[model samples]
Target: MITFQVKDMSCGHCVSVITQAVMAADPQAQVQIDLATHRVSIEPAAADAAALREAIAEAGYTPVPV
Candidate 1:
């Protein structure tokens, strides 16, 4: 499981986009978003933080390690 900070996530729409982005990179990944804290937690089948970060970036959000 990897938890990262996405300071711009502030709404349900943002969550949806981020979820979709992560899923695009790793379909089996489990994504959880906490808008209140601006954090996204992902439990991926494999360890690929860089891939995940790139996915988030492609989604239009900045991912910072927690």
Candidate 2:
């Protein structure tokens, strides 16, 4: 699984947005968001950190490498 730290995720709406973005990037991906840690974990078909980061950014959040 690939993990990203999303600094802008602070609520349920943020979780929804992030989840959508990740799913859009990889339809078959399994995404888990931890609001307490501000972390997003993705088990994608493949590891594409850049794509993931871009997706997160497009969703209006900042993704920090973890």
Lowest lDDT 10-mer window, candidate 1? 45-54
Q: Which lDDT tens digits does candidate 1 get at residues 6-63?
A: 9988899999999999998999999988999999999997649999999999899999
Q: Write the per-residue lDDT of candidate 2 for residues 1-66, one digit (tens) a residue.
A: 789898779999999999999889988888989999999998887638789889999999999978
TM-score (C-alpha) between model 2 and the true structure: 0.92
RMSD of each: 0.9, 1.1
Give lDDT per model, in order.
Answer: 0.92, 0.89
Candidate 2 — what's its lDDT? 0.89
